[model samples]
Target: METNTQTDQVTNYVYIHVPFCLRKCSYCSFFSVNFSQEASSRFVKYLIKEINLFKQKYNIKPKTIYFGGGTPSLLTAAQINLIISQFDIAETEEITLECNPVNITNEFAKELTLTQINRISLGAQSFLDKELKVLGRLHKADEIRNAYKLLRAYRYNNISLDLIYGLPNQTKEDVEFSLDEIIKLEPEHISTYCLSLEKDVPLFSKIDQIPADEKVAEFYYLIRNKLISAEFEHYEISNFAKSGFESNHNLCYWNDKYYLGFGPSASGYLDFNSKTVCHPERSRRRDHLIRYNNSVNFEIYHKMLDEKKIMIDKIILNNDDHEKEYIFLGLRKAAGLNLEEFENKFKTDFTKKYDKVLHKFNNLLEINERTIKLKSEAYFISNEIFSEFM
Candidate 1:
């Protein structure tokens, strides 16, 4: 494996994890807890200390910052600002916060916007009342509309709304109605996903009663047609964006660029020169900074941090590891990979290395100089294609 430190590039994206929520949704398996104003205040203090450590150690400055669940909006505006103040975020940086519509008010939206958090990703899930109840979302259908209207009234220009299909007892008409409602709002971006029944969640126990595959496919087709007609680009399998409105932060991940992930359950990756970088299936380097997974227990996290053993898992990437990752992560984007770039990373043509697999599955995967996107027919079976390399 190549070990050249000088040639490696530094990552400029930073992700901060906020693991507190007002309540747990049945479909959610992410780490989050019941809301506590005092706990949030204390968490912010530790967060700042952690950020300072990064600056002192690596001298890294971030160009994009993302604040993800559990219910980032549950945090007070002051606490959010406290965290933001620590980073020398570039003027053009895209800062995003994820929120459940129940906690979003006009005042809160205005305050967050003023604090330079220009983008808000509202977990709207659905606009149908019965579906919202079944999903255990606290917000009502009207509340979703009202909260979005409030954001617009507060002048939030970059807003993304999340919608879910494949709800139990849902029909084609119901999915279309959800898309219609989303189109009416004209959000800058729309993320449409199928309901995933996670293990140990309440929904998982009742998964058998969920919509059948045939109906689920119908709902997916309905969403594709509606959103495309509405002029939103189906940039990713699950993300739709208008022109110049694609999510830059998310793109960083799909493009396999380096990013910093902070907070419990958040993961970060950066390239290191001295380390032996292995692929995700065979990685074992724990220096060049750490892979910090914060605890679901904030108290435990605090105690661990004070003892300087807060890192839950850490792996440093070597050239070969980074090269393999370029294939897996790059394939996630709709545009796929650039052939020349792949050659530069691996010092070999990826197509040449996998020619046998490519030749055998030519009809199923689209391979070209610019990309290797899966055909629409092969999308649902992507795992089968991805496994060929391993």
Candidate 2:
């Protein structure tokens, strides 16, 4: 909320969404369509147009670029290059592409390296075949192993393995068994997420079959301790990484920095203050914090962009909304919030602003004059603590 013009200028991260999949996962709620060469080609063209529109509007020079999916690996190397070529990316920008195991091959990896993509996030949900089937994953446990070896053989050192826990009938031992493989594999980063049976997803039909909340909390601690013991830093709620391997793109989000997201179902945020001041010496006439989303309907998106309609829903955040998001997102990081930074940004005394809530949850949150963080034991109940800020 206290994000001034200078903060906006420094937060130019980019996210490109490719929403096509061969099959849908039972737990997913993201907008995506079935793959077709003709449809994908058409979508790519529209995507380029959308990217250009943002580039023109914001004049952004990106610090990091994230290619997220419906399996970004499905696109040919040539297609990848075509999209990236349009961007004014830094030479050392962290270009990340999320991939599926079955889509990775040694030949494909070589071609992919040519695109200058430095980070590859392999979707290795679980090592147990039974659990994989429960989540409706396309590849088997063996394919995860094959994909890692293939990428390594091609010299892709900065790889991140994504894992899921708290599935139906999952246990602490099962989580430990999977971590054995993850630890042995020794990825530069590890992202472990708890399964959510979102409404309307196929898995929601059997929500009763999933583990209890208590069980899921146990699984959370199990994996947290595993990564810590293996010497991986728990940098975020669901992310662990070796030193210097934390995701720069994702860090932008938790730190409440401005980022531009392109493609259908993608969301973006921007903040600035107009220089038209009533008093010549004073800062800003007014601060504008805008968040926008493109149309999720693929057909509608294409028609709008092609005709220059650009069906984007834009919302201007009020002071309350911005301040709430600032605290909420900042608390998710492992190093936690700096008291001085928070106070300086918002032009407020941090402890004084949320005195009641901080006092109420004092046992769960560790607060000092300099910083504030959730205690390790209270991480599972973070939502409840964050709600007080709301």
Candidate with best TM-score? 2
User: Cα RMSD (Å) between model 2 and the true structure?
Assistant: 4.0
For model 1, how does the per-residue alpha-carbon lDDT over 27-127 read when each residue is reduced to its tens digit?
88888877787888777877776666455444356677899978889887888888888877664478898988888877787787668688889899998
Can you give the lDDT of residue 180 in candidate 1?
92
On the 0 to 100 scale, the lDDT of residue 296 in model 2 is 82
Of the candidates shown, which would achieve the greatest lDDT relative to the real structure? 2
Q: Which residue pairs collide in model 1, if any?
A: 277-318
What lDDT is obtained when candidate 2 is compared to the true structure? Answer: 0.83
Pick out the ten consecutive residues of candidate 1 with the lowest summed lDDT.
1-10
Query: Local distance difference test, per candidate?
Result: 0.76, 0.83
- What shift in Å separates residue 316 of candidate 1 from its native position after superposition? 4.3
* Candidate 2: stretches off by over 4 Å: 1-11, 272-287, 309-311
Per-residue lDDT for 215 in model 2?
Answer: 90
lDDT per residue for candidate 2 within 28-120, as digits (tens), equals 887888988888788789989977765544557888899897778888898899988888776437999999998898889889979978899
